[model samples]
Every structure is written in C-alpha cells, then in structure tokens.
Target: MGIEYVSVDAEYPMCCPVILCDICNKQLTREGVALRMESSTPQEPKRSPLYFAHRGGCYSTISATLEDLYGSGWLELSDNLKDFMTQLAHNFNTPLEHEYTQYKLT
Candidate 1:
C-alpha cells in the first residue's frame, strides 16, 4: 500500500483519546508509526483503519504483514517503503558508536 501523511484522532472505548500499539496493545506515549491499506481505485481511494504501533519492535510486525500480502521482496518493490523501514529501524536500534550521541541529544 502507498503511504500518505495524515493527522489522526482516536476516541472510542477510552474517555481520553489515545493511540494504542496494534501489536503490544499498549498506549503509545512517544514516537510511533501508522500503516494504512489503500484501495486500488485512484479516483476514490478507500483507506482501511490505521494500524498504529511503536517504532521499534512493534513496528517491525508490518514486515511480516507486508510479506504475506506482497511476498518476501516487498521492500525491493518500492524505494519509498525501503527508506521508511530504514528510518524506523534506525530510530530504536542505533549502532553502539551512535548510542552515546543519540542518548545525549534525546
């Protein structure tokens, strides 16, 4: 599915609006990612409900979902998807050398 940036607000079972991780089922308190499925129609693209998850482990669950939907080489099909995955991976799993720098900044 193609990616589109959109603002979201969620309020249902909870009194206060909160986004929960689709994998872990916990409230997301910091950086997270949203994945949505887009319909084939370009004129009237119907998007599925957003799948929200934390950027590190939870976000990696999308890889299995994507592979199941689009086969194993899903990332190879689109550079945009690959870049997005790369950034998410880097967010929580930084290299040892960069860890100190990242911790300092954050």
Candidate 2:
C-alpha cells in the first residue's frame, strides 16, 4: 500500500509548518522561489513525474530527487519525456508565485 503523486504544477503551498523532503529528510524550504511538488496521492504502481526543490539547484539534489520519486517502481510517466519535450514547442516565459483569486483565466 504505497502512495503516488502527480505534480501538475511546478510549485506547492506548504500545508505543514515543518515539511521535510522525501529524499533528504531535511526541512523543505520555499524561501523566495516557488517550490516544486506533485499534485495528489493516488495509489497506483507505475512510472510518475517528479520535481523537487533544494538548495539553489545543487547537483546532488537531482540524483536524490530522482531516486526518491522513481526508485520503487511507483512513478508513472504517461508520455515519453523526449517525445513530450519535442512536441512541447511553446515556452512559458515566466511563472508568477501568487494565489489566484478567480478560477477562470479569461
């Protein structure tokens, strides 16, 4: 009985006052930049997409984040990364870290 996470967005608002990283077991801090996290916990056994925030893009952060996200065969990525990236031609210039007061974009 394991849990799964789907990180649709690139950041998360911390629910817990003291949140720890699944990889580092250290405090997860979103000092200024918006942090990365998965969406929900759905129980499924497969590949998944994962993103993490650490001390200013430290090299070790990448390795550790991957291991934690995909190690035990819990991760499920519906699309191939290369194919997705290639097809994803448009770019989002910048992202703002703020709460949306309204639901509709237009």
Report, for all candidates in order, the number of backbone clashes. 0, 8
lDDT for each residue of candidate 2 in 1-106, tens digit (9 for 90 to 100): 0113334345874343333344444444442111222234433222233433344443256545555754432222223233333333332444545433321111
* Candidate 2 global Cα RMSD: 15.3
Clashes of 1: 0
Quote the lDDT for 82 in model 2.
35
Give me the displacement of residue 15 in model 2, in angstroms: 10
Model 1: how far residue 79 lies from native, Å: 16
Index of the highest-lDDT prediction: 1
CA lDDT of 15 in candidate 2?
42
* Model 1 CA deviation exceeding 4 Å by range: 1-15, 69-106
Candidate 2 residue 58 Cα shift, in angstroms, is: 5.5
**Could you estimate the TM-score for every candidate?**
0.44, 0.23
lDDT of each: 0.51, 0.35
The reply for model 2, stretches above 4 Å from the true place, is 1-18, 31-47, 56-59, 64-106
lDDT of 1 by residue, 1-106 (tens): 2233323546443355455666887665546666654344445533244466667787788667765765443222222234445665797687544322111110
